[model samples]
Target: MDLLRVRAARPAATGAVLAAAALLAGPAAVAQGDSTTQSDSTSPGTTQAGSGWNDDAYRGEVEVIPGDDETADMVSGVVFEDADRSSTHDDGEKGVAGVQVSNGRDVVTTDSEGRYELPLEDGMDVFVTQPRGYQVPVDEDNVAQFAYTHMPQGSPELEYGGLEPTGPAPEALNFPLEKDMGAKHPHQSCVIGGDVQTYDEDEVEYARAGAFSDLAARKDYSSCGALFIGDVVGDDLALYDSVRELSGMLNGPARFLPGNHDLDFDAESREHSVDTFRAQLGPQYYSYDVGKLHVVALNSIEYPVGDGYNGALGERQLEWLRRDIAEVPEGRAIVLATHIPLLDFADQGSDVHQVDEVAEIYEILEGREVITVGGHTHSIENLRAGDSLTGWEETFGVEELPFTHLTAGAISGDWFSGEMLEEGYPTAIQRDGGVPGVITLEARGEHLTERFTARGDDGSTQMSLGLNTPAYRDWFAAHEDDAGEAPEFESPLEVPQEDLGEAWLTANFWMGGTGSTVEVSLDGGEPVEAERTQQMQGEGQRVGAEHSDPTAVQQQLVHGGSIADRSMHLWRLDLPEDLASGTHSAEVTATDVHGDEFTDTVEFEVID
Candidate 1:
């Protein structure tokens, strides 16, 4: 049978009882996708996700499973309304019809009685797709309880405790949802933060002062809430509490997806690797509907692949995705959130950094209004439809992107690596010259307009201005290793006439990409259009002094961080040699595809 045809019979409904909290205001909770064929046996190629510090004793251990009759194992569940706010299905409580439920691979909608059944196998995760107008029950830690794992025999011997033997399938595995009467708005705001990646308490505090604090102050995204996509911790699962404390600052629901660093590398089998993550976070992958948006978050890391990791969706996830998407109505806009990028402008030459099943994933999502947002790269990118990159083209035969793909820049920019700022944080600029920030997707129905909000700054701070003079380039090259102690380049506004011909004005518009424009004006004169360095249309990377953002390069090279040698949003304009020796002021304006303009000015002396 083709992988797409897997289906299971419907099952009965189950329930539990719990006290209901008051109706909450703000955005809906975090929603959390895949490629591969259907198979009864575990595929050898399907590696586990999550990574941690390597230990010699955990090397070369293979995942072992005992074969059993598929017909003997069946999972039955009910999707019911917990009337009186109790999670249990009492005499008067009724089932909710048409609710989709899944045992990972097979997707079935609840009948009028709000009951669904699916084939359950060992080591399978069963979950319900949160429908619009209802809220899933939350645990004490506020983690959603929409999923249940069934492992009859438990995980094989391994380090880092795996799922304990589930004994047998509960006679009634019920999922409870409370009716949420909050009006769904036509316009919804979704906050996206990437790679909080806090390594210790200090970095967690840095995040607190930076992006998290900014999020704490905003109340706009009460519907879609805030989603932190991957790298939640830097290989230190113990700090999950600290990360959760940061999320606690948000006004809306906060949800998370596990990153590479959030794994247990010592587990003997891939099935056991994410035990800690599952114990902390609710589910590895799940989906939810809010307003008109159908959001899907995926686990994109394949750990310990030759002692490292790669971006992929193994057989299980892929099959689940195919089935899941099948239930989605045609033409509904889909948003995918993942840890590793499906495709990105950055790391275009590295195949390992992108999903191995890009083509298949696209095929599954064909003819849909889709946009993918990912973290892990720690850089910002706004790749649009038809965008092409050499790595994607050559590696996956993906000629062009079918829709938008944006890389959400990290909250812990450059791993919290940079000079301490007066604002009580670091100036940890990203490789693409984007400062630490959160990305916002404002949608009216299926139409979305993206906006990036830099940490510790207002929305107006969308671009950076720098004079890319020969002197500045020289300064960048000389102080490559001297972070925090490098002397500031004085009189940066003054430039010798000899340096003018070779010098240029640079603007790094953090969210600018394919359809955006940057123009420079001297002395309030005509604005001369500057050229974008990286067109991102199936080309190799453009790097070095000729294509760098002098402002970010200076700070990164001097203050310890990834060099701003290449960018997808950098624009440059050469200064004319005809200008006489005197003071000159240049005004730069960056206009994004949304017709929004951000302006900045720089003044320099044309020294004789």
Candidate 2:
């Protein structure tokens, strides 16, 4: 064993991001036009990044040197600096010391010589935790190649082919890293997406036109890149290749965790469930560092023998988590990401949609500055510290939040169900009334901020302002069960004289929570505080059409989508019953915990 050496901050000669081998960014390009027709011209694929012009997937791969002739008991590797930009380490290349390597449970740092050895198991993933300032090699499709899967017997018979059997353990699974200044810079933007969930070729094109194109147009996240926190596909694992192609369309390297839908239903056991996903995407769970932040991507779903799936991390993974967290330096900013949320406001009542061991996980990171992000719930919830929910306390025993728990809204909102827009995608209005979008986790100095950007829309599209009236609620009650067949809620914004007393202005602030505030101003008057529907403190959920967003529900009712029956981010303020019956314009503003304000306008009327 050799003593550790400090890694220099300097980068290699090549200026391109070696991990993504991102095609040279030039002037922007416009994606293919949409086929669907719409009165509004706002659509996805209207503008795109240069990466879409040439869908290059020339990024290299990981180098796995075969083991010796005799059966090996260990999987060994050297973490080296790829000075010449090759994915493989040449004889002249030197190993970088102090880089961490793992075999699911054991985490060992490289010595001065940059070599590490771990006891190997039959179905373990041998991986390297990408250190700060350096990036691991990526496959042709921009999928990071930090880990190598070792499956001796492969998976038991499954619908989609699992990992191909590796006859013997590799002698050396060397990982190559390239220096990148942008990756370690203090200011970083990391994109988190939920539920790409493309079920068919048409849905694939929808994703291409929707979020993927949106991601392609943005060049901000070259370092931390984008992490699709599961549901990369819908049921069919063969679509993994298509998803990989989608990743190649990104302007940066892409990482993904396994969602429940990305499962192998034919598997006999949980051990081999996501084998094909691991082979196609990265590991089932892993960690990496960028600047001062450490991100741990976890596989939160658990499918058992003779049972359906649940939101439980097996003991094996729990032990791995213990080891993984122990390795991170104390006080380092940690971002815990999962496919199914650990704890969320949307599914605060369900046992399966939330992690079963949330309290235990919280205990593990007690002293650190941490924020958790997750997918699968298909809603945007930004629950801040000290926020509490009745079901959260009863089900998970979490009295109040220790830190932030964010439910990153889905890219394929409401599973691509709604009126087809000219954007070539459905208006996937989420169950929370939030439009389909992705979360951008930004690091600013010591604080990390999370912002949601709607698909094909600007940052100004943060909140939806509308009127939720008694008449609209009655219509919702009538059409509640008529999904995909409901008649349009007639004149939703116009409230009759009788219902005006009970009508309220609603603002669906997508990322609003306990510390956030929503204010309403009628006809340029003073802004009045709008009450949040759910306080998230020991109260049973108040769900019904009354709590729903009129803007989203109106769109969902006639077209087809998840009805916005209840949302934690919703706020309502009663309209003045004595106001004259005429057209009136109101301004709604939502201020988040970070003190950033988003303003939107709604024009409504009172009728006789």
Candidate 3:
């Protein structure tokens, strides 16, 4: 680790960046015509700071490893410094030592000469896990290119098309890497977002104004960039360009995974299902490194199973996963990013909504510090280890989770449902009462803390509190179909004396999970602990008035959104039946797993 160097802040000029690289940056090259362009004047091949071309992966040439024979049953590769930024491993450019490469089921480290060989199988995807301070090449759309498909035969006849098989095994496959001028270590902000499912251009604009705009305004997370955990676009593959445009707003490198909605449903077979997605995004499953953290993005959506998709990883991918983790150095922090969750509080009742082989995945990650993130549920659920759910137990026989699993709330909250907001977007409250937002994982070495940022709200805003009155419950039943048409529920603070006994104060803590505590107090009195609605301890979803969040339900019922019928992050406290007739204020404080406290207040009246 002593040999590792920290990257610094970039200089304004491209010439300054080249000068700072110790002349490692080769001669200036012609600007490449890409669909998206940066605001900075730096050439695409330059490794200058603030040039917006800081990703080293974008500045290299492709080549084959020097001394390897064809017709070999083993895969050989050389990881080298792309001095010319040409992607090809030129003669003058030397091989980089101590790099980790994988063949989906086995891991090998480049020797002193920066060359490695591993047993190869047909149709296997060979890739190099990028190291810190170095970047792999990225395409015009900023999709990282680190893997090579070695399919001997092109994809079978399918609608979307699978990998065009390479006619024969190459003598050697080489990987190119450029030095990162702005890499950060020890402390990093990684963005984990979910479900930007834009069905049309209108929704694309909504995403632009909503989460994308919010992300664009933030300067943090430039190190690891942003990872969209699947559903980049709707079923229409044509909209991939629009999706790329959305990512263009990001300040750092952008990566994506595939979701059920992102599949080629018209494909004749499963192998060719994600062809268009692969052509647009990067690999279906891959890994990368930042500081001491190793990030693994897995494809969890299995299409053409029968009538619909299933949350599964085919045997090959699973085998690759086993090999990938085996290569990770012991004690390094691992972050797993995927489309469908392994086990989610939102879909604890459905078998098809979560990964089918959670136990196997858990076993692979055993004895390691890990955090898993997914986006299919369109809700925010920060579940920790030891958390158990009925669905997981019945389906995968998972007694308890082995690590933290966070279901990232969607950027297009509830598929862009609800009334339009003044911010040029919809409220789009999610099914679990969480607002549309991006999740931030602040990492300092192997330990990290997770935080949620609502689409337009400040960082401090974490939960919404309101009184669930009898009148509101009646209104919910009557306006089930009146989306964006029903009148707003007025007089939230004025509750009749008759309704005070049954009324409950509801708290919708967006990222709250097990070990979180919510307390309520009236008029600054003694705070009473509020019970969480869904314990997720092998029980069914709790719904109805006692469990539902009134604040989210109000907007969801009348404004067209996923019904807030059950929530894992919702908590309720029954109000006192014998209260003096007067106006009172209830102060609510929610403390998450990290001991971070968020306070909110709501006033209600008890009139005789």
Candidate 4:
């Protein structure tokens, strides 16, 4: 119901900030009046600032501000320690003097005290850049140590609430300063996922009932945390509470990055662009360190009001990013998480949504080991080592998925529409055949291996039935008139048992209507019709969203035709049994509503 409008056409320059402003509005609007201020002096609180206010002197400070009228209460502070903890400002930990802090649009900052004051917003998160040498505290759980907890009355109520330790605000929000003690490289891992955009309560339930449930069951990530890359909800901000509740199930800390859909539609300026997102999910963009990795989450959505917007990082955020990444050791591997992919995928020439500052971001980490993850496309693409796509300046796109630049498929998969499965979720088939799921990365030292887990398959390698179009033509015409139309195809495209391999029959039956089933058989065996369940998967135009009439446009934005047509549906069937080494044949059949039936056969070979 809260859908934000995506631009119908692509912008001329992807780097223009105005392009982003023209596309979508979010919550973090820059405020017109001076920010609301709160004095910590009213209640005695610790204050620390460095010497030589005007002179170039290494200085640092911390403060806690309560929630108030003009702005929400915020307990924000910064760390001035550099990587070596020498108490000297280094490359990446340089303090960003006069940087504005806020719960949302209302902003404030530290003065000569390196101390800032402001009332926290409900569910607001306050964090400061770790000034070069100092490090913030890490909870026993290894959640990045923070300066304060602003949930005065604990986390708010919802399906999923705030962090597990629900209660009033802590006595004093203080971050003890300490040098980064030379310790063993922390054995840490962070779960990176793209687009958990739940459209409605049902989709939320689907997420809860599926991959999320699986994630909650694992205690492995109790150390580092889970970082979701954007589109938290399809269009519904209300789902944030539910998402938080689900995250509460995690064994470790959970953080979020803003995507296009996460934008507050009512947001008026760049500052207020991600207000609700920040309030519920912490900073829109922030950096943290874990083990040997320096993870930086960036806000890619540009909400330019005056000048044209581009897909690059906002000027302010970019400046902060330079400072943030500069502090890390050149040897440390950095992971950048955002919602939109920095490079083009299905659409290469369009600039309406790709990051314009790709080169700038690249320059910042020119020599450092870096990997990036994004989601907005709702399809899975692996930019392996040496892979390069069009539109990306050669220097920027040539590297293989250096550490895996994964375009995580959306959680809502094709917009949460399709055949309803027993799981009470739609079997939303993706155009590319990748199913809805999450990605897990195992990082030991500088080496990281990426694994994708589909919703129903657990940890099995994602394999879908690569259904070609020809097979569906006969099936569609057979049931063209039936209300509950389906392909008149037979079960199991017969294949020698050995050639079956580990293939899931993803029937791309362009004509199969709702409730269609495709049963498969081996040799002369009974048919095992792969169940028709609705789950979101892949990329391309989903069945329901409004699109410009195909006749009106010479080119279609998404591949494939509309799913609304009975002839436009695609289905998938997982091979019931693993294939042995050799040749095999499968017989597939489809049943139509009028009792009509159609059959087909396909053969293949599988080697041991």
- Find the candidate with the highest lDDT and give its number: 2
- Output the worst ten-in-a-row residue range by lDDT, candidate 3: 23-32
Tens digit per residue, CA lDDT, model 4, 1-608: 01011212111111111111111110111011111111111101111122211132122323332334333233444433334434333455544344334433334554653445555554445565333223444332223334233444543343233333324442233333444321124434457767778877877897787667766655455435578888888657878888877775554556778877776655556655566676566677777666666677888888753544446577767877776665566656677888877764433345756787876776777666666778777666544334344334342443323333557666666566544556655544343444567766545555444445556543422222222222233333344344124422332233344433334444332223333456677555888866543221222223321111111010111112113221122444555456565555555555432223344444444444
- Model 1 ranges off by over 4 Å: 1-72, 152-165, 181-183, 481-487
What would you estimate as the lDDT of candidate 1?
0.72
* Per-model lDDT: 0.72, 0.78, 0.75, 0.48
lDDT of 3 by residue, 403-448 (tens): 8889888999889987686678877878887788899876667776
Query: Model 2: per-residue lDDT, tens digit, 95-176?
Result: 9998888888888999998899999888898889999888876777788888888887777777798888877888778988
Runs in model 3 deviating more than 4 A are 1-75, 118-123, 150-172, 181-184, 481-487
**Lowest lDDT block of 10, candidate 4:** 23-32
Sorted on TM-score, best first, the list reads 2, 3, 1, 4
RMSD of each: 13.8, 8.9, 10.8, 18.3
Model 2 misplacement above 4 A:
1-58
Q: Better model by lDDT, 1 or 4?
A: 1
- Give the top-scoring candidate (TM-score): 2
Report the lDDT of model 3 for residue 316.
82
Error of 1 at 85 (Å): 2.6
List TM-scores for all candidates, in order: 0.85, 0.90, 0.86, 0.57
**Backbone-clash count (model 3):** 14
Say what the RMSD of model 2 is.
Answer: 8.9
Candidate 1, 1-608: lDDT as tens digits: 00011123112111100000000000110000000111121111111123111110111110122334434577776788876655666677888999898887889999999988888887777888878776675544334567877777776654545567766666667788776533154456788999999889999999998888887666566446678889989988888887777765655566788888988888755666676777667578878776667788898988768788889878889998888888887645688899999988787767788898888898898877788999999899988777787777778788888888899999998888877876777878788877888998766666667888778754555666667888877876777667556666655556799887898877787899788898888888999999998888788788887888767766666567887788989998888998889977776777776666666665567898
lDDT of 3 at 168: 63
TM-score preference between candidates 3 and 4, better one:
3
